[model samples]
Target: MALVNTKEMFKKAYEGGYAIGAFNVNNMEIIQGITEAAGELKAPVILQVSKGARAYANPTYLVKLVEAAVAQNPDIPITLHLDHGPSYEMCKACIDDGFTSVMFDGSSKPFEENVAEAAKVVEYAHKYNVTVEAELGTLGGVEDEVSVEADKAMYTDPEQVQDFVNQTGVDSLAIAIGTSHGAYKFKPGQDPKLRLDILEEVSKRLPGFPIVLHGASSVPQEFVNIINQYGGNMPNAIGIPESELRKAAKMAVCKINVDSDIRLAMTASIRKYFAEHPDHFDPRQYLAPARQAVKDMVAHKITEVMGCDGKA
Candidate 1:
């Protein structure tokens, strides 16, 4: 099977009460890990590229890598998406470059400007049969090229959701429900809660329309402990609880963004490998185990959290 757009996938997920995992891809191992796990579980997946990831790994290489994954796993559905595209031009460029889905992240812009730019990108993307995702509110924390201070982050105003959707015609709406970017989503002893009231209101207004959640990774404590024990410092790193995400999946949220968890898993494995074997200088010697760790993490998320393990 070839790469697919999210239109049909989102429709199915909306009716099925589950959300597809949108994992950010950086290199070959990360892509391999995510796709392998999703394929094994027969789950539909989205391999998304962030601006930083595009800068790190060339855009063409990432797109071809996703194509290769599709060739390897012909049964599971996969969508290549641009995560948080900053400008109309960037979104258009990705659409032209064969991304089946693109996100125009104008959340930080003025409301009217954001709607106008998103609408522009939507118009362009629709012409190419590419789905567009637009963010309604800013999510805080640093990951890739997306960074917003906590003071600047705001919960998506439920009142504006309908207008935003009607004006932009975005294929999916990413709303800020208290989840932030990166592993440190919440501070120690702070309650990590999603604004389900806001989610409820958005669902009431948008009914069957697909919704998206950014910064949805539940950072596994095992990885954090392993990294810290093996000469790494990721102190007080936290993430959304899996239970909350499961509830969100049952709502209109048909797509969930995850990146930091994969990073944590790979980093922990590599750290442990290096600490145990000081003589292994070859990249494969360490990267192989790191890739396996990522695969395991993704499999766990699909089966336990997202509940899309066999929905492919």
Candidate 2:
């Protein structure tokens, strides 16, 4: 099947009480791993590219990689998306380059500025049959180029959701409800809590409109342990609990972004392989296991947190 926009995917997820996994992709192995897992699980998946990712892997290469994935996994639905597009030009570039969906993250801008810019992107994106996602409120932590201090993080105002959606004409809304942007979402002794109350209120206002959650990866302890054991020093790297993500899925959240988990899994596997076999120098030797780790992590997410295992 050809790549599709999030419109139909989100609709089905909303009605079926599940959320599609939006995994960030920056390389061939990561793309292959995520698509392979989604294909096996018969789940719809969204492969996203951030600005930093575009810089790391050229836009043309990223698009071609995703296209190859679609060709390889013809049975499952896949969407190519631009995650946290900083400007209309960026969103337009991705849409023109064959992205099925684009997210204009103007949350850091003033409310009016955000609405205007997002609306402009929506106008351009819809003309090309590409769906747009907009964010309201700010998330804490760092993901690629996105970074906000915890003190600056703010919960989305439920009342503003209706206006943003109406004015922007975005296909989905990503709201900040306590889920931060990166691996260190919380402190060592602090408890991680999502304001489901904010989600509830936003749902009531928008009714059936699709909602999205950024930084939704539940950083698996096993992967963290593996990385630490193999000469990595990531301390207190926590994430949203799976139970909370499942709860969000049962509500209006139709799309959840997961990036750190994939990175950790791949890094851990590569570190372990190199540590145990220092004699190997072939790139494929280490990448093979890293790819497998990505596949395993994505499969676990599909069946566990996303609840999108068999919903294709």
Candidate 3:
């Protein structure tokens, strides 16, 4: 009926051995596609807004789009989340603007600084009943304003998780265990692997804690092929295997953030549509199919990858 925080969702996910899909939202079609699938399947979903998205779509428009989704899907629990908020000001703004959850990503900063900044955000967000998510290690690849070289990426140290959580008092912890951002996550002929061992250690150290995974999209080759087939140039864009993500869900991962897959699905669909109908100049004509493709992809993720189809 209204925007809900991730607290109860993550709690149920941890106990049920499933993960909730946190889909990125920028415009009306993306939000419509995500919430349509979620409402139809009765899955609780998180609609996250990145800093870049906020700038591109205008924060006010994004909020109105999310509120529209709330009105349209009264039976499903949906969350308006700030994804990868770069500073306390951004987090505070989102929390005050009606975001149910916010993520303060200080992974690139010094550990002590990260803890301090995240604690500051947590202290303020709690007063409004908003949940905070903080990151531990850096992830590689480009996504919006977040990027790190592969050489600079670090696996989350399980040893530091407890102290960081205790100091920051965060509701969720995002640890970089090997998943990278964007489409070109892996190179050709290389098997994508996740450091599940690190994840296991972190989960053991903080039992019953909710773990968040960023850049967890399982880039469907079918979408890549469709894009490539229609003149797109995304090559060797591999993602974490769904099997691996499912395993992590069974472990301790409660929230899995998926962005690139949504991009690929819509891009591939629009590309194929444009190629097929070169005469169509109507935006609605092409966007309808693109929106449907997004719906299909998200529905698949809800039922297959996220395992949260009926948990709403």
Taking all chains together, each candidate's TM-score versus the true structure is: 0.98, 0.99, 0.98
Residue by residue across 64-154, what tens digits does model 1's lDDT show? 8988999999999999999999999899889888999999999999999999999999999999899999999889998888889989999
> Which RMSD does model 2 reach against the true structure?
0.8
Backbone atom clashes (below 3 Å) for every candidate: 0, 0, 0
Which pairs clash inside model 2?
A: none
lDDT of 2 by residue, 107-132 (tens): 99999999999999999999989999
lDDT of 1 at 28: 97
The runs of at least 3 residues in candidate 1 whose Cα sits more than 4 Å from the true structure, single-residue gaps closed, are: none
At residue 297, what lDDT does model 3 achieve?
A: 92
* Model 3: worst 10 consecutive residues (lDDT sum): 232-241
